[model samples]
Target: MEKREHWKSKFGFILAATGGAIGLGNIWRFPYITGKNGGAAFVLIYIGCCIIVGIPLILAELSLGRRSQRDAVGTFKVIKPGTGWFWIGGMGVATGYLILSYYSVVAGWTIGYFFESLLGTFRKMGSPQAVASYFDTYSASPLKAIGFHGFFIVLCMIIVIRGIQGGIERACKLLMPTLLGILLICIIRSVTLEGSLAGLTFFIKPDFSKLSTQAIFEALGQSFFTLSLGMGAVITYGSYLTKKDNLASSAVMITFLDTFIAILAGFAIFPAIFAFGLPPDQGPGLVFRSLTNVFNAMPGGAVFAPLFFFLLIIAAVTSGISLLEVITAYFVDERGWSRRKTVLTMGTVSFLLGIPAALSFGRLQGVHILGKTPFSFVEGLTANYMLPLGGLMISVFVAYIWGGRKAIDEVKVGNPVFITGRIWVFLLRYICPFIVAQILLFGVLSEFTSPRVISFSEILRYYLGIIDIVIAAGVIIGGAIYIISIKRAKRREG
Candidate 1:
């Protein structure tokens, strides 16, 4: 097998990782979740979770890859020889493919909106009904969505085929900074609106009374999504990290940058919504319709609207590059294929997979997986189930089977502070697994407990939901306890 290469410079790694962490999840999903939850209170808890859980998991993933010097599949095999943990790597690759399939479709929306904003189409739009019609006409058109998705996926493949330094790093070096600069300008403009202060207050002020169990779960889910955790995306990127790189500091920097972008995006989005009297919880429609209207009606509407969407497209594209890279790397490293072959094959597959999502708006609208909506069902399964399940496996593999204390030490390398103390172990052994298990169980229960008029054809949906939760809970608890017991025995023997 040809030996894979590490990033030539630290900045390259940072840019690529930051690109992965910052995406539509920040601009599109984060704001709505914040608005729907207790705003700033949820934001605060989310930041806390990002620091405690996100940073540690990131370091662990990067350290594992750097130490093993292999992509997701080979990384586990190399680190803990003969262990079945490599299956986690396989899951990561599959998750990446799943992510790209739907994500390309969403990215298509951003691209379409970018052009619309540039054309000043929103200026003539006055009523919410007009906005609804605009979206209905454009967003539901299968050909338009497919064309943009195909374009976005091809762009991603071009980057991956160019190899790491030439394609991925070079693009991020220009795109990430440009993304931040555009966001800051938008934030400044957003805060100048008449009702901006109220928007800020809504986002910053913690209303404990508004927080619910569902809100807490939502926060957890957002944190996972925002950081790109549990998708094996990070682990695949981590494979390119050099041993000299400081995983702890790098993880912290990426986390901080990701959080900053999310908060800044809130500042850009919410004030505009408030000023225009638009509902904040418009879900994905918030970006497609609501924000487009805001840009249209703003002072420098023509110029700023296009610029905002352009920035959004760049953010989405950078993240999509990471998603594509995960599967591409798996093929190249594990299957002994050329980079071009890997990218072309994966890109074609992803493009074909995305068609269902793209067509969900038109001719394929009748195709229903479960009784629920098609897009929603796909998003729920991947985001809610596969993501957390992947995270659980990662935590167990790093904290128990592979390296354990050795892994901690590797993460702490080149840093003055060490995380190998009992406190770190306690969280890895107890808190992380416990939180993940709860999320898994609640996710399952919520699916069943929700009122849905069911038919015999849909009976399997409810049964699978129950079975998924049971198995997930059992695996998480079983793995955590088993690992802790082993550590105790090792200590006793010493």
Candidate 2:
């Protein structure tokens, strides 16, 4: 067997994990969702979700990985043999593969736009409509789209092939700080623009009336997705952690840093959007179309345009590395593949898988799966179904099958007397699983039903309210009673 590689330092592990968490979603998706979901109200709700859901899951995955000293699939096998629970890890590996496949295509677009911004291409386009047209044309070109997609995949391959200390850790150390530095610069420039305060006001002020059931669920989903949980990326990174590294503090730091960057990204982009009088809810095009117009019109636009896109590329690459790593680790741990063979083979295959998504914008534009483009279909499948289900299963397995007592013992390896083990396990055992199951159920219903007939939120509000209340009460009461039993057991043991 090949010797396993470990992270060189505690800080290296934190940076790499945080880099994985801070991805394109943070750049493009989170801000727009915040804009659409009542700004500060949604932001506060999201923070609460992170505390209640995100950290416990992180701790769960990390402790499992480190304790098993294996990849996601292997972690399950090592921990619990002769059972089907390893399929959970298999699902996670598959989820990472699917997410990274098309994700690289979008990452490639950031690379393409970075160069275009550098060459003053957006400067030539006078209106957001003009920039939107240019984006349409550019995305429609099969050659450019696939070429950059391949390019980004190759970049990920290069970094991951070098192994952990020399590659992922080293790259993330440089990338995360640079990402933050550039983000700070963008925030400064964005807020200094004339009339930028309007954007800031819109972003920071809470309007409770604007908050809806849909917005609450969106916040829950965003908090879950933004942390990169349920996909085995965290598990793979955690497998590299040393026994001395504190899982609790590390999870907290990673979550805090990731959320901070996401909020700062809003600060960076929202002020510019409002200053230019662009609609806040510009959807996915907020980055490529709306921001390009902002860069074209704002003072010192030329210099910051490239910086902004470069920041995006770094963000994409960081997360891309994690997704690719999840797949690569599987092969290395399970199949006895060398790092080079695993990275090269899997990265190439991922790039090939992404080609259809890349071409979906251009040559494959007419093709639709289940009434959506290839890119949209795959993105929806992973985000809506696979990730949430994987997360829900992980929480259930750790809390029930693997047993929360075992999980807490594993987590206590670095911090022997940590008091929050009960709390963490309570959330992992009860709260996280229930919420993620709701997300999964809601996503399925939303996908299959015509919102024109009856929306999923409406179903939740009008039809399922009593059942939801019963489930919530049961979980809370069950968790509290379970905690008391644990306390009694500890007392007897003492």
Candidate 3:
């Protein structure tokens, strides 16, 4: 087997990992989630979740990766030669592949919007309606959207093909600082708007009254999903680590930078959101539509319009490349494929897979498997089920199969002071799996049932009739497998 590649420097790995964590979701989703949930109180819950759930998972992923020095799937196999543990990594690889398919589609939109911003398209849209129409026109354009989608894939392919140090790390090192600088300029301009203070106040002041049970799960989901947790992406990145790198500090820095950038994004956007009198809960189009109007009204509209959109594209690309690496890492490590072969094969396939999602807004708008856009349908599958399941399996596999002592030893590689053992293990053993299971159930159940408890009977009917079928089948098949295995073991002994 070919020798594995490692990060050239610890800082480079951190930046790359941070770039992965800081994606389109951080830019677009996090602020809206915070605003819609509990404002600053939601932010606090989110922060707590990051500390309790997100950071611990990050450490687990990094420790697992650096110790095994393999792709997500390979890492599980390395620890336990023949077991269901490998499926955990396989699920992670599939999650990364599945998410990236549609993720690249969104990244492509950012790219198109960047050019639109450069042409001052957003600057002329003086009203939210006009901005919305503009976005609708652009989004509904099949040729333009798919063109950008294909282009984004090719661009990511370039970086992934270059090998770790030369490709992924190099792009992130440049992208991170540049993204921060552009964001700072936008924040400065946004805060200077007349009513921006109200928005800032809205964002900073805690309102514990708004933190509901659903919002609690929302915070956990956001924190878990935001940091690229539960996906193989982090573990794939971690696989490139050298022995000298500290997994704990790297995970902490990645979390800190990712969270800081997310909050900074809130500061930058909320001021504009309130200052312009836009609706804070406008769903996915908030950034592209309403914020475009805010950009038009700002004094530095001409400059920051392009700058902000450029920032969006940069963030998306950095994230897109990182996800691409997960699939690339698997093929390269486990299949004896070269970097170029893996990148081309996986990148092309992902781009092709994304076609339906890109077309979902226009060509396939009405096409639904179970009353959801193709994009949204896949997003739900991966985010709700696949990603959380991957995270749950990882926590369990590390805590039980690898054993607590060995897991800690992998984590304690660079630290003489290993004090995080007790709590981390406890969370890994119990809390994380349980939280993830709750997230999966709630995430799905919310779609079919109202958050209100007005009709318990209706929910129970649906749960028993539909949900229980999947559960029952799983149990039945699992029991059959166990019985068959036991009988086979007895035969072998005889």
Candidate 4:
């Protein structure tokens, strides 16, 4: 058997993992979501969720990967042997591939926009409408959209085929630092604009009153979503780590950097968002449409606009590499394919499959699945259902199936100092799984509801009522009791 590829340094592992977490959402969605929900109020909620909800779940997933020393599918198969648990890993791999198909297409648009920005394509865009029109025109063009998608996927393919230590580690070492540097530059420029203080105040001040029923769930979703949880990206990345690294510390580092970059991205955009007096709740095109307008309107925007878009493209590339790595790792580790063969085959197939999604905004515009466009349907299904289900299953497997002692042992693999094991287990066993299950259940129900576009808060307020709250309370309290009982029983046995 070929030796399993491992990261050369702790920094590489953290960078690779953080690269996976920092994606298009961190750049586009986070800032806008923060602006709309309660500015800094929602950010605090998001941070809290990241701590309790994200860290535990990802640590569990990473522990599984490192312990099993295999891809997601291979990990379950090795650990459980004869059980159906491997399907969780299977689901992760499949979900990653499906997500990548469309995700690459969107990533491609960022690259396309990067070039256009450099070329000063949007220099003359006077209003948000003009920028919106520019996005519509490019996205609706079948040739342009597919071409860009193909380009982005190919770039990822090249990196993955070069193997872990050489390509992924090296790319992230370059990419993550560059991404951070660019964000800092953008934040400085944005915060210094004439009307930027209002934006700063709005982002920095936390007013709890903005907490609505939807905002709570939105924060929950973002916390998980932003971290690349539930999708096996962490699992896949973790499989490559050296056995000497501490899982807990690595997870914390990745989470800290991911959250930091997200907040930095918010600073970069929210200040501009307030300066332009644009609605913070503007939808997904915030980057392509609204931000371009901000760039066109800002001082020295012609140059900075391109730099910002370039950073956006790199952000997309880093995350896309992770998504692609999830898929590539499975084939290479489980199916025994050569890295080159797997990369080429999967890359070709995924790029071809992505063509439909590329056209979804253009040629396939009107087509809908469960009331979502082809592209949106793919995203909604994976993010809401597959990812959450995968995360829930990972939590259950680690906390219950594998047993608490075993999990603690896994977390303690290399580190001499370890205090988070017990609390992390509690969160994974009790809080994370139940909450993710709620996300999964709600995600499914959303498809049938009228207009099919109600918020999580709305879903909870009306149809579900206090049932979600009651369930969550029951799960947390019951979980704490059960864990205590288990430990006590073990102590008595000893």
Candidate 5:
């Protein structure tokens, strides 16, 4: 059989990869998380983690994928051979599927907001409380949310079914730059607001007291998810790259662009919140509710409000397309399914699964899978636990078992400049996996152990307690031992 063709242009690959990275999470989650977690201190930690942990893992996944030239499942099978590491690919595809189910629902909100903004619905909505209630009403309506979600899912499926070059690449090329441009415009406008400097200071100022076990762990998790690392999204996308493509440079570019958008979003949003005297820690409603109010209060509230939401919708749609492609590609490659079949089947399944999240606003509010939690339990489990575990597995598989060092060598073969081998090896072999595993274990334990309504002082005390440090250390050591033992067994076999 003839060899499969790769992405013809670097722009296509970058756009597609970036489309996966820049999503609703960046726009909605980043600002609020930054505010609650010591503003600038958290942002700094997040950036550090992104470079040290996110970039290396991205290179590892891309190297693995490009070398194998296969979907997520096939990539693992090629690298690890007889080992069951290929199941990581399956996990990734599943994770993408699970995420898109609810993710599309949230994406639907952006879509709805885009139209509402355009029509000047927000112009008359004067108060933050009114904007908050608007979100509450819409979020609780299952039928309306489902309608918009279906629209978003279909749009994603249409683009994904067209293959990498024709559909995914073209959309990203047009959208990514536009998304960045909108963000910069928003940032410029926001920074000029009265008291905007306070928001900026809040985001950039460091508070060492805020450094706790849980905060560090949360930062680690955010770094992983925000960059779309460890869930096989990057790896699966990487499988399409040509041999001459520079994995290191590509990873760095993707990380930088992703981080820039996230930070820019913070700059745009927080200033507006402060300007309007809205609460900084508005939880998930910060973007949908608080920012909507800010737009209403602005001079040209109607015009800018719609423009902001339009950019958000575009960013979200592109990201959704990438997630769908991961699963769609797996089905096409592994099960020999047609692209249309794969797209439709996955979309239908995701659409149905999204109903719970949609209904969580009202009727299903009492439905708790883990315990007494409401809307975010399912989201939290997948993001905090499954994503990190998948990442740890990839780190170990590439760094130790699957010849990631060898793959890195292959990746650097044609480049004029090379990444520092020692640093790359150190991160791949020790630092990345250790950090990821620590976050995963500690995050789970803390969630289970910590009270939901604890006082601020008590929460602070819990973070600095001896127990937290021991837990973090134990998790890291456990990962190192697992990887070392696997390497030893492989050596013995050789």
Candidate 6:
């Protein structure tokens, strides 16, 4: 095999990894999730989840990658050789590819909106209704949707094709700082607006009465998903680390930077929403619609409008590079293909796969599979099942199969006095996997059941019937493979 690339510096790895963690979800979904889920209480719970679940997994993945110095799939194979455990990494690579397909379509919207705001498009709209209608019209345009989607893919391809240190590390060094700088500017302007204090109060004040079980689950889920865990992105980035580098500190710093940016995103958005007397829980529409109205009415609307969307574009590109790199890493490591061939071939195919999702907003909006539109179905498949399953399995593999003691030994190579080894292993063996399993079940069950459950029978009838069967079959198949792989390994050992 050819030599592999490593990150040139620890700082580059930190920025690149954190940039992979920070994405459109931070800018749009997180603020809305926090507002509706008991504000500061939810935020606190989220931070705890990060410490308990997110950071441990980050350590596990980073250790696994650095020890093997291979792609996600190859890392598993390197450690367990001829075992079914490598399929976990295969699932991760597949998950990244699946997510990148539809994710790029939405990332494209950010770029399209950035250009639109830059060109003074929102200035022409007089009312919130008109602004919303404009978004609907733009989203419903097949030509524009596919055009921007292809554009975003091409941007990612260019960055990922340049090799690791020169491409991903270099681009993130520029993009992440710029993203934070623009975000600070937006927050300053947002808070200075009259009546903005209402938003801040709502965001910072936590009411225990408002906190629900569902909200707690939401916090746990966000903490896991927000850090780009279980999707091969972290593992792929970790593959470039050196033995001298501290995995524990690197994971914590990446988590800290990601969480800090997410909270800052709330400050940038919530103040503006409350300043304009708009509802904070507008869900996903808050960014495209309500924010447009806020921009139209604000003092420096034209200037800040472009700045905010530009920030979104930057966040999208930074995250998009990592997703594409996940796929690129697989082919380069496993198939021995050149980075250029892998990136171009996989990038083009990813774009083609996304065309259907792009069209789902326009021509295929009415079509439904299993009571969901094409876009929603794809989103649900990955978010609700693949990601959480991947996370849960990784924890189990590291704790039970690879042995947590061995994993920590790998982690402690750089930090000789690493103190959290026992606690981390315990969490991985018991607490973390259970929490991720809850997230997985909630994600799957919530799709078929209402948020307000009135009876046990309701859950049994709506939630458990089909999903339970699917989960059971998966467990059985996975168990069989594990048993077989282990028996084979023992035979080889003998």
For lDDT, the strongest prediction is 2
Every candidate's lDDT:
0.79, 0.89, 0.83, 0.83, 0.79, 0.86
lDDT of 2 by residue, 1-494 (tens): 56899999998999999999999989888998998887888887788678778888999999889999999999999999998889999999999999998989888889999999989988886666889778888988999999999999999999999999999999999999999999999999999999999989887888878877677678778988889999999999999998988999999999999999999999999999999888888788888888988888889999999999999999999999999999999999999999899998999899889988999988999999999999999989999999999999999989998898999888888989767788787787777877888788778777766665465457674444345435546755765787688778889999
Using TM-score, give the best candidate's number. Answer: 2
Per-residue lDDT tens digits for candidate 6, residues 1-494, read: 45799999999999999999999878877988987786777787777678778898999899888988999999999999998888899999998888888888888888889899988888887767988878788888999999999999999999999988889999999999999999999999999999999889877887777766566667777887788889999999999999999999999999999999999998998899999999887778888988989999999989999899999988888889999998889999999999999999999999999888888877989988888878788888888899999899989988999998899899889898676677678778977786788778766667756446435434544453344335435544654676677668778989
At residue 23, candidate 6 shows an lDDT of 91
**Positional deviation of 236 in candidate 5, in angstroms?**
1.1
- The order by descending TM-score is 2, 4, 6, 3, 1, 5
Which digits, one per residue and each the tens of the lDDT, describe model 1 over residues 1-494?
55676786888889889899899999889998888876888887678667656776787778877877778888889988887879988888888788889888888988988887777677777775687668878867988989999999998988888888889988899899999999998998999988888788888888877765456567777888878888778888888887678887888899999999999999998888888787777776887777777776778878878888888888888899999988888888889988888899989999998888887877677888875545666777888788888887888877777646887777666554553334455556655676676567656655763356334314544454345345435644765676687678778989
How do the residues 1-494 of candidate 5 rate in per-residue lDDT, one tens digit apiece? 22344686987888879879989878887887877786777787678778778888898888888988888998888877888878888888888777888788888888888887887776666656777789889877877787898899989988887777878888888888898888888888898998788787777778777665556656777788888876778978898898889888899999998898898899888888888777677788887877887887787777778778888888888889888888887887788888779888988888888877777777887888776433476687778677888888888887788765585686685454453544566777877776787667655655654365344434654554345345446544764676677668778989
Better of 2 and 4 by lDDT: 2
- Tell me the alpha-carbon RMSD of every candidate: 6.4, 3.4, 9.9, 4.1, 6.4, 8.5
Better of 5 and 6 by TM-score: 6
* Count of residue pairs whose backbone atoms collide, per candidate: 0, 0, 0, 1, 1, 0
The segments of candidate 6 whose C-alpha lies over 4 angstroms from its true place after superposition are 449-454, 457-494
RMSD of candidate 6 to the truth, in angstroms, is: 8.5
* TM-score of each model, paired residue for residue: 0.89, 0.93, 0.90, 0.92, 0.88, 0.91
Any runs in candidate 4 off by more than 4 Å, and if so which?
126-128, 450-494
Worst 10 residues of 3 by lDDT: 463-472
User: How far does residue 177 in candidate 6 sit from its true spot (Å)?
Assistant: 0.8
- Candidate 5 lDDT at 473 equals 62
